[model samples]
Target: MYAVDSPPTPARSPQTPPAQHAKPVRRRSQREARVAWLLSLPTLVILIAMLAYPLYRMIVLSFQNMRLKELFSGATPPWAGFDQYTKALTDGVFWGVVGRTAAFTVVSVSLSVLAGLGIALLMRRVHSKVRIFMMVAMMFVWALPQLVAAQSFRWLTDSDFGVLNYVLTKLGLDYATHSWFVNPWEGWTVITVLVVWAGIPFLAISLSAGLTQVPKELLEAATVDGATPWQALRNITLPILKPLLTIVTTLSVIWNFGLFTQNWALRDGHPEPVYQTLATFSYTQAFGRSNYSYGSAIAVITVLLMLGVMIFYIRQMFKIGEVD
Candidate 1:
């Protein structure tokens, strides 16, 4: 009989791997990814509820012409279509306030940074007990509430019964008894002094922390090479601390830009347009004038401007990081 023709065995491609018979790896990878997202779901929800929600609401409110009266009235507020933004951009008073705020931020932040750096440097060489005492004092000052600090400043600089003037009078400097909160220059002086005082402690503490991370040998080597203390600090300490300095300075700028309670209290409720910052301006518009939408626009603008400045500083910090 003719050899029985058997059905030819299905030819398997030689290039095909035996592993192809196993389950798909992609499915496992996707399952792992799902598990990861599930694990992080709580944190994501918290962030969305806190940061993202407020930000979204603020942006939405900015485009609405919602006045204060309608805030609690449950009305469908009309769309403003950038009307408030246009008004704020064109308003001379708003521009003036912005200019003043910029100047204030620059001067106040500079002074705070310089003072804090100086204090930090001094702390590095001080006795243990002295350092502890200094730290405690600074912490106390920093811990004081803004309202209390502002009030204390008012009392300390009071025109008539102020302790500062009383001491000055004893020293025969009668001019020191003049009011510090009436004239624009004097008021600003008082405000700057207080703000700088309050801000220095935090900056100094952060700098001190960064200082400890610096290699002591580098500083010693610089000194051994006939470098003066200042030269050693400039060449060694500062180079190492640049990233930290950028971070601290950026934070100070952010804090100072929105200085409200201290400044508002300094004005003693007689807030003038000349001295108002974008923050105070927003508050006045929202609460004082009951113009919620316009105030929201101001708030949005302030956040954008702050973000712009912060991004510049953060980029510098990241550049340093990359170099390292």
Candidate 2:
């Protein structure tokens, strides 16, 4: 049998060792990490410069008894330890402000979310031209500065020469020269309305974007199975939109809880005690009453509260990322 040297045995190409392959990957990861840190350095420095020292000073101030005397004299204020915190915690007025802020946040967030969700759903069912028109209108409103919007609302709701008063009188209602702020409920209603109106555009646009991710096939299938629109929404649409909704709702809570510019401007830069929220309360205590340390204490408490909300938001965001 002619052992014709079986076609010269093909040489095996040299294989890279696993350890050798891993070295480049480790080096690449280290390089990427260095690049990321380098890119973030500017932001880190800015935050430390702008925020870190101020936050540290504020916290320190909260532990002192800094009043107008110390402020003007530029003298170190005496430390009160936790006395400022204790006073705030025990004070009825402080509690009232906290309660009012919490209540307004709940109401405003609920109204804004519901209205935004409704408008977003409505946009989905509308014709393309109509959707475009709605978007244009909302964009204009959203693009309008908050200060401008607040000023406009203030003008509209002016007690004497307001268009609202004029229209109400024309319609046979006795709204002529009527002060909306006379009643706390009425004043809050106006504030709530302004906040909701301003917030809706953002919420509507964001929710609308999220709604686009809903599976058309699932909706059609649900329809084919005789599911009502509401049923389809509850089962399919809402479930899909829940994460986005949570994020927006949490954001609204944060924004509305702050509750400063609207109330401040509406009341003409000096919100009344009845209209006082946490932000206004802190400001009033600090500048209006010159109780700097007390204001700092309230601000510290506010930050802690906000931190809780932020933690919740961060956790939800992480969950969304995992799902994706």
Candidate 3:
């Protein structure tokens, strides 16, 4: 047996699965990617044509003196070389407009989000029938066109024959034939009220939807542990709702900061310089005064401000995703 024994046959290295086996999978993935791109192509094209081109044109216009003359004559606008920006930056009135816009955004968004959160919490505690009715009413308001709402508010606040003044007069507050717009403060109050009223439905509904995701079990356990409703909300429910709250808050900020319809409508399509926001201010400069390049520059700045808000929103969303 020893004489017959031979060196053990060299062990064969383990054969790898053939690389050929991966080729079809790789090809399929490539094919799927191609299909996905194809599916997205139309949307990409539309966005580029609609958003990108207009943005590019606006940017160019911001750097050029393009008034009605240039616009109508189809002539190339003279290069402005930062003059428009300088003018905007130097103008105290422009700064005032910016400040007013920021202030309104803060006040309106704060009121909206707080009121919305309260309403959402209330909805949770209400009978199902009541909840449904509230939702129906809010949905009706939300669906009402902004223009119509603004017009209705205008009518309600009208000086000569306003129901508001009539009611206040009836209550002996001496509001008979009171002009709401005489004082900028009063005008702004009306505008803010209308904006807040219009905005609440969206925020409440969205926050209510978010609240449904809060775990009943967790809330029950917290209750069992003798945690107060506030403590439970602050600790448990808020943490769950934080992401949605952030998203809605950011959107509200964006919408309120722009602030066109309510202010414009309330002011009768011609907001005074005192009531002007960035949006209306730019519009007044461009169309009302025919200072196109200056208006474009302001518009550019507005877009940048919005971009900052969007960046913050995106960062919050990313953080929320990581937490999830």
Candidate 4:
């Protein structure tokens, strides 16, 4: 009997059922989803009513042979397909305007960003009171309505009664009072100056914020390593500030491309269309000549160009982020 006694076998608990193991927790119900959609219906409807209709109308009008007469006579405009687009492409003035717009954007954005960076750096070192004063002055320039700024600049650069001419004369410089708006290059120069003046403040404020994020410790370390201020800015500050720079430059390009008020108020369609950007050209086509279809075509092209630029900008920004 003693030899026959054996160790007792260990008992195991039963395994969980396959259904219990595999089952998922309850999720949102169809009814709940439907309720959420119902709550969002007003925003959806408003977007369709306000945005969708206009966009659809614009696309439809762009493809039509609609003119002022057809619009007024209540006649259904004939479908033109790509005729308007072809015409726009072949137009010499369109190309000229494109070139002028590009030039203006490049010059204005370059100067504005550069000047803004300089001012932001300068402000970082100055007394708080001086910085505040400079900021106030910058805001004054920025707060001047675009039209008023354009007009004031025009008066200041006038051929006859300009302060510039007076100043040059007073300084004993042989400066002649030339017609600023008469020449194509001169007209663009004036527009560029006004744009840069209006735009630099925005860049300065934005870049200043970015500059503040740069670590003071890193800067001090660089200085202790015998790095010059310029070297520190180049090697340390700029790399940290790249994202903000990209944003500022991209926004500046977009803004300058769509610029209307400064160009319109400053030159007022002078210099035989040489100073016209896409915005002004579209306006002249739509309102000046009542060519609705043609105007829509121009607008569509401008929109496409802007879309392309934005796409590239976004791609570049993502690439920069990835690099970091």
Candidate 5:
């Protein structure tokens, strides 16, 4: 057998130098990293300047004996250690305010979430036009300035010459123009109403969006399997909506916990403190009484409470993600 000479082995094109091949890729990666950092720079600067600095200052101030006088006089106050914290913790009014604030948060958030869920469910079944109208109405109330709404509601609920009393009398209801601020429960009721009104829109919008994301196919399949409407909602829709619910509820807790404007406006020039939420107490300590150190202590406590709540919420969110 004549062995045909093997065709000349194809000459391999000289491989591009490894450095040449890698250079462009390394340069491109560097360029991408630079671009990402450039895009993040503004947010980083703002957070450091606005959030970090203030937090640092607050922590420093909390440990000092600083007052408005010292601040204005530019004198660095001597450190007071944990005295301020101890005082705040031991104060009767402080503890009382804490309880009131807790009650306010729980009642208002619960009512708002319940109300929002009902409204969202109703809107889901309604015509798009009607849903839009209701959404706009809720948004209008939500978008109103907090101070403006507080003042307006204060006027409406006034014991003397108030429209609420007028309407009640007109409707032949027993209407006594008693001072609402004198009664802690009545004052809380008004505060709760204002908070619920402001809060419901957020929950409604969030829950509505969540509801919209519930797959029609899943519901249909559930129905095909003889599941009731309620069963389908509980098993499928609720599970899907949990993340949104957690987000809305956590946000509502934070917002309501820091409530000050409504409580202040609702006080309406009353001399005796009626509804003293934690925020109001902090404000009273800081500006009203010029006790900056004490105010900082209260603020720090409030911050810790909020942090705890957020941590719990984050844990729940991760737990939900892990659930099958």
Candidate 6:
């Protein structure tokens, strides 16, 4: 070999990895992902148990001819397919109840929001002590259970011994012992009032929070620009409050649309089928008539409606983000 001095070969090092021998970055990322999922496993399990499981069961029940007798006899409830859904969708009474529910929700939500807005505005203008009292009163009412509130309505409207009847009698309305439930208007009025009252505190508190975010400078500037308070509210306050309004009203619709405890409790004393809202109607079919599948179908429809509200709420949140 021509001893042409080959350049001294560089020493191979143990510390530095060659390009082909590099650590697996993707492997590390996958491991981190697995660790994160493991950490969240408990919450995932809870949600599956509480929310997902029931939803799955309901959907299953809605498609099958479920009955208490079938379960007790250990007999399989056959797949009814769309029979329950067909019945629910075709029933004139069901459709009427749905119409009433929509009207009820509209009235209750509108009045509650308006009342809350009024209260919020008044609180802003009132002395601190008066504002505190109003807030406390609203909170106290909100703290009452819906069942208890419904019972209170019953007591207040009792034909024989109601406080309201007593007051009306004292005011010289001789027919003050009114069978309130007999009249659709009166029964719905009580329900509407209950829903409105129940909804006001949340709406008021939220609107107050919205109010805080509204710059005083804007109001003052509007006044400087010769805008009346009403005009300023119509133009500036409402535009700024659109997001809050959308959220509150949508939530209220969801809550009121599916109201069960209060509606059931209020009508328990009488049990009028005509007085049924969608929630009570579902209850009637499920337990009252032992038609579980049909009830579940109704429940599925209600869930779909609420899901629409949820989707609306999420879209609104995204829109707000884009605006910001």
Candidate 6 colliding pairs:
none
Residue-level lDDT tens digits of model 6 in 89-138: 89999999999888988889999999999888888888989988988998
Q: Tell me the deviation in Å of residue 278 in model 6.
A: 1.3
| lDDT (Cα, tens digit) per residue for candidate 5, span 1-324 | 998898899889898999998999899877866866687689879979888878888888889998767988999988999999999889988988898788888889999998998889889999999999999999998899999999988888888878888888889987769566677787778888988988888899879988998989999999999999899989998889888788788888988988888888878633245577888788788878889988988998999889988887767754554452
- Compared with the true structure, what per-residue lDDT tens digits does model 3 show for residues 61-161? 89999978888999999998899999999999999999999999999899999999999999999999999999999999999998899999999998988
Estimated TM-score for each candidate: 0.81, 0.86, 0.85, 0.80, 0.81, 0.84
Query: How many clashing pairs in candidate 4?
Result: 0
- Candidate 3 has an lDDT of 0.91
- Give me the candidate number with maximum TM-score: 2
Model 4 vs. true fold: TM? 0.80
lDDT of 6: 0.85
Q: Mind giving the per-residue lDDT tens digits that candidate 2 earns over 154-187?
A: 9999998899899999999999899999999999
lDDT of 4 by residue, 138-162 (tens): 8898898888998899898888889
lDDT of 1 by residue, 1-324 (tens): 789989999998688565774456667656766866687689879988889878888889889998756778888799988898998999998888889999999999999999999999999999989999999999999999998999999999998778988888888887565886668898899899999999999999889988998898988887788999888888888988888898889888999999899889977865887778889999999889888888989999999989987788767755664455
Instruction: List the global CA lDDT of all models.
Output: 0.87, 0.93, 0.91, 0.85, 0.85, 0.85
Backbone clash total, candidate 6: 0
Model 4, 222: alpha-carbon shift in Å? 0.8
Superior candidate under TM-score, 2 versus 6:
2
TM-score of 5: 0.81
- lDDT at residue 10 of model 6 (Cα atoms): 95
Q: Residue 126 in candidate 1 has what lDDT?
A: 98
Candidate numbers sorted by TM-score from highest down:
2, 3, 6, 1, 5, 4
